[model samples]
Target: MASIELKNVIKRYGKGKTANQVIHGVNAHIADGEFIVIVGPSGCGKSTLLRMVAGLEEITEGDICIGGRVVNQLEPAERDIAMVFQNYALYPHMSVFDNMAYGLKIAKVPVDDIKSRVDKAAKILELGPYLQRKPRELSGGQRQRVAMGRAIVRQPQVFLFDEPLSNLDAKLRAQTRLEIQKLHRELGITSLFVTHDQVEAMTLAQRMIVMNGGVMEQFGTPEEVYTRPATTFVASFIGSPPMNLLKDAPDAKPGVITGIRPEHLDITPSGWALQVEAVEMLGAERLVYGRWAHSATDQLVIIRTEEAHAVPVLGTTIHVTPRADRLHAFDAATGKRMMTA
Candidate 1:
C-alpha cells in the first residue's frame, strides 16, 4: 500500500491564447490503504484526474507523488498501480485462471508463483470454482470479479477503478459494492474509484472528491459533504432529491439563499403555505411535490414523509416548516455557503 499526493495539479489542451483548461488546480493527499472515490457528473474531469494519477494523462502543472516518490515522468506500468476499467476487459478465449495469470506470465514470473498468486486471488474473489470457465460463460458480476482478481494478483500499491460497476444491474451493483468493501477490508489496498453515481460514492468511499466542470467542488468524507456542504453546488449535487435553494426566502437577507432538504421540511399546521401539485409513493416514504402558496413564481418544493403519514389532496393547501438547525444559507451571488456568526 502507498500514499498518493497531487499538488496543484492542472490539465490543459492546446497552448498559449487558445489553451483550454480541463482540470483546475486540484490538490489532494490520499493516505495509505485509503479508499477514495472521485465522483462527479459526466464531463466534470473526474476520469481525467484519475487518468492523470494512473499516468494515462499528463499533468500540465504540479507534481504527482506515489509512496513519497515523484512520478510525473514515469509510465503507467512503472507507477506500480493496477486499473480495473468499466468494460471488464477480459479475454473471451482465455479461462479465468489464464486471464488472471496473464500479467504474471508476461512479466516472466515463475509458473509456480503465478499459480500460487492466481489461486490466492481466485480464493479471495470466490472464483476458484470458475477458474476453468471462459469469460463468455460467466455472469456479469463474475466477469467483474475476474477483472478485480486480475488486479489483485498484481499486488500493486494502488488500485484505480473507472466506474467498474456501471455495467451491472441494480442488484448486482449493490452486491458487488459490498464485495468490494469486503475485499478492501481484507487486503487493505489503497484504491481510487471514479463514478458519477452519488449513491455509490456515499456508500463505498471513506473520503470522496466531488468535482464539477473540472473544478474540485469539495473533498471530504460522505457525512461532511452531505451535512455541511462547502458550496451551493455541493449542497445540491450530493443529495437524493437534492437540497432546495429558495431564492428571496421570507425573512432572509437580500443576497442569501435558504437551502433545505426534503426530509428536513415537515408538514405543520402553520408555516409556509404550500399547494400540493403531485405525490409519489416510494415504498416506505412518500414524496410530496408542491409550490409555495400565494407566490407568483412557480418554483417547486418537495417534502418527504413516512408512508403512513397523511397527505393532503392534490391542489390542497398545506403548511410546511423547515427545521431551523437543518437550514443552510448560501450567498446568492457566489453560490457558496455563508458562515453563521
Candidate 2:
C-alpha cells in the first residue's frame, strides 16, 4: 500500500491565449490504504483528475507523488497502479482465469506464481467457479468482479476506479459497494474512486474530494462535508434534496443567505408559514415542497417528515420552524459560508 499526494495540480488544454484550464490547483494527501472518492457532477473534472493520478493524462503544473516518489513523467505502466474502468474492459474470448492472469503473463512472472496469484484473486472475488467462462457468459456484476480480480492480481501500490459501479443495476450497485468495502478491508490497498453520485461517495469513501468546475470545492470526511459545508455550492450539492438557501429571510441582513436542510425543518404551531405546493410519498417518509407564505419571491422549500405524520393538504398554509443550531449562514455574493459572531 502507498500514500498518494497531489500538490498544486492543474490541467490545461491547448496553449497560450486560447488555453482552457480544466483542473485548478487540486491538492490532497491520501494516507496509505485510505479509500478516497472523487465526486462531482458531470463535466466537473472528477474523471480528468483521476486520469491524471493514474498517469493517463498529463499534469499541466505541480507534482504527483506515489509512495513518496514523484511520478510526473512516468508512463501508465510504470506508475505501478491498477485501474478498474466504468466498462469492464475484459477481452470477449478470454476466460476469467486468463483475464486475471494476463498482466502477470505480460510481466513474464513465473508460471506457478501467476497461477497462485490468479487463484487467490478469484477466491477473494468469488469468481473461482467462473474462471472458465468468457465475459459474454457472465452477468454484468460478475464481469465487473472479474475486472476487479484482474486488478487485484497485479498487487499494485494504488487502485484507481472510474465510476466502476455506474453500469450496474441499483441493487447490484449496492451489493457491489459492500463487496468493494470488504475487499478494501481485507487487502487494505490504497484506492481512489471517482463517481458522480453523492450517495456512493458518502457511503464508500473514508474521505471525499468534492469538485465543481475544475476547482476543489471541499475535501473532508462525509460527516463533515454534510454537516458543515465550506461553501454554498458544497451545501447545496452534497445533500439529497440539498440544503435550502433562503435569500433575504426575515431578521437576516441583506445579502446574507441562510441554509437549512429538509430534515431540520419541522411543522410547528408558529414559525415561517409555508404554502404547500406539492407532496411526494417516499416509502417511510414524505417530502413536502412549498414556498414561504406571503413572500413575493418564489423561493422553494422542502421538508421531510415521517409518513405516519398527517399529510398537509395542497394549497394549505402550515408553519415550519428551522432548528436554530442547524442553520448555516453564508455570504450570498461570494457563495461562501459565514463565520458566526
Candidate 3:
C-alpha cells in the first residue's frame, strides 16, 4: 500500500488562445491503503484525474506522487499501479488463470511464482472454480471479478478503478459492490475509484472527492458530503431523488436558496402548505411530488417517505416540513452553501 498525492495538477489540450483546460490545479491526498472515490456528473473531469494518476494522460503542470515519489515522468507500467476499466478489458480467448497471470508473465516472473500468485488471487476472488474458463464463458459479473483478480495478482502500489461496475445490471451492480468492498478489506491496498454514480461513490468510498467542471467542489466522508454539502452543486447531485433547492422569496434581501432532501421532508398537518401534484409508490417508499402554494414558478419538490401505506393522496392539501437541522441554504448566484446564513 502506498499514499498517493496530487499537487496542483493541471491538464490542458492544445495551446495559445485556443487551449482548452480540463483540469484546474486539482490537489488531493489519498492515504496509504485508503479507498477514495472520485464522483461527479459526466464531463466533470473525474475520469480525467484518474487517468492522469494512472499515467494514461499527461499532466500539464504539478506533481503526482505515489509512495512519496514523484511519478510525473514515469510510464504507467513503471508506476506500479493496476487499473480495472469499466468495460472489463479482459482477453476473450485467455482462461481466467492466464488472464490473471498475463501481467506477471510479461514481467518475466518465474512460471512457478505466476502459478502461486494466480492461484492466490483466484481464491481470494472466489474464481478458483473458473480458472480454466475463458472470458466468453464467464458471466458479466464473473468477467468483472477476473478483471479485479488480474489487478490483485499484480500487487501494485495502488489499485485504480474507472467505473468498473457501470456495465452491470442493477442487481449485479449491487452484488459486485459488496464483492469489491470485501476485496478491498482483505487486500488493504490504497485505491482510487472514479464513477459518475453518487450511490456507488457513497457506498464504496471511505472518503469521496466531488468534482465539477474540472474543479474540486467537495472532499469528505459520504455522510459529510450528503448531510453538509459544501456547495449547492453537491447538494443537488449526491442524493437519490436529490435535494430540493428552491429559490427563496425575491423580496428577502440576500435571500438564500433553501434545500431539503427528500427523506428529510415529512408530511405534517400544520406545516408549510403545499399542493400535492402526484404520488409515486416505489414499493418500500413513496415519492410525494408537490409544489408550495405560494411559489410562483413550477419548481417541484420530491419527498421520500417510508410510510407508503399512509402516503397522502393526490390533489389534496398537504403540509410538508423539514426535520430540525435538515435545512440547507445556498447562495442564489454563487451556488455555494450558506449554512451559517
lDDT of 2 by residue, 1-341 (tens): 89999999999999999999999999999999999999999999999999999999999999999999999999999999999999999999889899999989999999999999999988888999999999999999999999999999999999999999999999999999999999999999999999999999999999999999999999999999999898999999999999998886677788889889999999999998889999999999999998885655768899999988899999999889898889889998999889542
lDDT of 3 by residue, 214-332 (tens): 99999999999998999889998999888988885333345678888889888887777777899888888889898776876667888898954487878887877777678778888
Please state the error at residue 224 of candidate 1 in Å: 0.2
C-alpha lDDT of candidate 1 relative to the true structure: 0.93
Clashing pairs in 3: none
lDDT of each: 0.93, 0.94, 0.90
lDDT of 1 by residue, 1-341 (tens): 99999999999999999999999999999999999999999999999999999999999999999999999999999999999999999999999999999999999999999999999999989999999999999999999999999999999999999999999999999999999999999999999999999999999999999999999989999999999898899998899999888886678888888899999999998998888999999999999998975654557898999988886799999899999889989998998889632
Clashes of each: 0, 0, 0
Identify the superior model by lDDT, candidate 2 or candidate 3: 2
C-alpha RMSD between model 2 and the true structure: 1.0
